[model samples]
Target: MNPQERPSWRQQSPEVQQQVRQDSEHFRKCLDYLREHSAGEHEGFYGPDSMTWVIYREPVILLGGLRAILLQIAHPAVAIGVAQNSNFRGDLLGRARRTYTAMYQLVFGGLPEAMGAAKRVHSLHSRVNGALPAGAGPQGEGRYRANDPLLQRWVLATLIDGAMEVFETFVRPLSTEEKRRFYEESRLAAAQFGLLPEQMPPTLEAFYAWYHEQLAGDALRVGDTARELAGLLFNSPFTRGQLDELLTAGLLPQRWREAYGLAWGLGQQRAWRLLKGTMRRAINLTPPTLRCVTAWHQAQMRLAQARGARPTVMARVLNTLDSYVDVPFSIRPVAAKTPAADRD
Candidate 1:
């Protein structure tokens, strides 16, 4: 079918139209509530930084969620083939690939840009490690150096775990079968990173702790301070209160305060300020509302056909046309607080 010639909601049955109307209304309500709450004191919660977080974070969550959904759909032996053939698997794998690529860019590409100022601090840590007495600790204490490659693997593992947790929290819920699928997929990814399934941490908290240890070592190597690491990863300034809140919210691990300090050394206050402005614009813009009246008309036609009504093609076309009315798009000035700063 020509893209523009595809049937509209009016071409669907009445039942479908009603369902679309209900869905539209539900979405509108949710959007309205978000806008109202976003304008309050908790503006930061809905700012551009937050939107970027969601955009970057959503695919990981969806990949996990869909894995769960597929498992549920495949529970019955007879449904396995149907589930496999559905486009869902392809869509989800694409999302996973995109997320992985983004993560790689964040760590390897953005890291330098985000941590330029922390190089000196990392050098200081390297000097301290080198100057430590030969008998600094017990016989085996220095065997596993902080900068070991193995430790870096562990840190990546924790990042994966954190990503998964965020997915579970904000995204759609899944069935038991879906959860099983998620585990299986996670295990495969972990294997690629040189980690055995048996070595995975049992709880999210434990994984985070392990992850932060790796970050600490990386800070030492990169000559960054704790604040710098925190700023790079969380995209926020390193304040004591912010650190406390991140820990409480399970956003960052506790022992890496020094790494976070180093990370803050590379902070760009202007980037965050611009992000805030973009968020304000996004929240104020109303989402386009869709009316699936054509679907309703189609349903009616289908019903009439089932009853041997024998309606002519012209009548069907007219019915579909009558069900919809388009209003011109209008721009309205939205009244909201001006952003704290303006950027070019």
Candidate 2:
């Protein structure tokens, strides 16, 4: 019998289990990719104690991810990459899945697994280059590649900056020292995508200045493709996306927000504030086990234990949700993973 259809699986909340099974295959495919492609040379990119793990595990990632996606495509090179290289518009959510899974593996998988995931991405990126739309300057001979260090920097920058924005808004503000270390550590993480140290902005201050300058100048554009992507995200078939629409707009630099046609009404501002306030308090009460990254990592360790592979990561999720991520089957999908802001 299939694992998901086993007798024990029949005992969970049928409604909940049904939803879990709906995406279990997708979850396993991502995990299986890591396990299958992992090499001995790749242990893992970051450690368990890293702040990136702490920050990323939170539900706030839902907000950060949506913000990052919107910010990335604004750059003409990234725009062209998405427009010509993939079916992002046709399968918007799938893009989110691929990006999120890749990042998750890079940050949390064993070194070999992370390397395997990175190698796959680099191979994909190497082939993805094209002409920029007429007005949006794509830098470097008017063509762009996924492997371009400059473009990689921008994409990584958006993730760090946007994730930190949501982190501060819905969680505690990091100390100056903490924030600096976070950025520096993040620069190292960005290297997993093939960035050189020199390509990265030397400091957080420099990064922000460059980021702001990009927004200030013509480094970003809302071409027909980006507009369609923005529409797909904000106007998703899921009504739950309304909050993401609001939060994503609220987080954007004002000019681009307006360009994306995302309005920031007084009502939206008040609601956004209320939402953040509520989440801050609620998240405080959340036990660590409920965090998606933590749960999945523990599950991976458990699977390793069963297979007699000494995993470097540690601990098990509280048993309640742990079984939902059964070994040799699939991990449960994180709730509201779509566009990373369905529930945000």
Q: For model 1, state the Cα shift of residue 77 in Å.
A: 48
Off by over 4 Å in 1: 1-57, 60-153, 197-224, 231-344
The per-residue C-alpha lDDT of model 2 at residue 46 equals 46
Supply the TM-score for candidate 1.
Answer: 0.28
Cα RMSD of predicted structure 2:
13.8
Position 336, candidate 2: lDDT: 18
Best model per TM-score:
2
Question: What would the TM-score be for candidate 2 when compared with the true structure?
Answer: 0.74
Question: What local lDDT score does residue 326 receive in model 2, on the 0 to 100 scale?
Answer: 34
Residues 152-197 of candidate 1: C-alpha lDDT, one tens digit per residue? 2444454455555544443434454544444444442333233445
Once superposed on the true structure, which residue ranges of model 2 sit more than 4 Å away at CA?
Answer: 1-43, 238-241, 292-296, 299-344
Can you give the lDDT of residue 151 in candidate 2? Answer: 81
lDDT of 2: 0.64
Residue lDDT tens for model 2, 39-140 = 333224445556776776676666666678888888767876776777655666666667776776676665655666766776565445545545555544
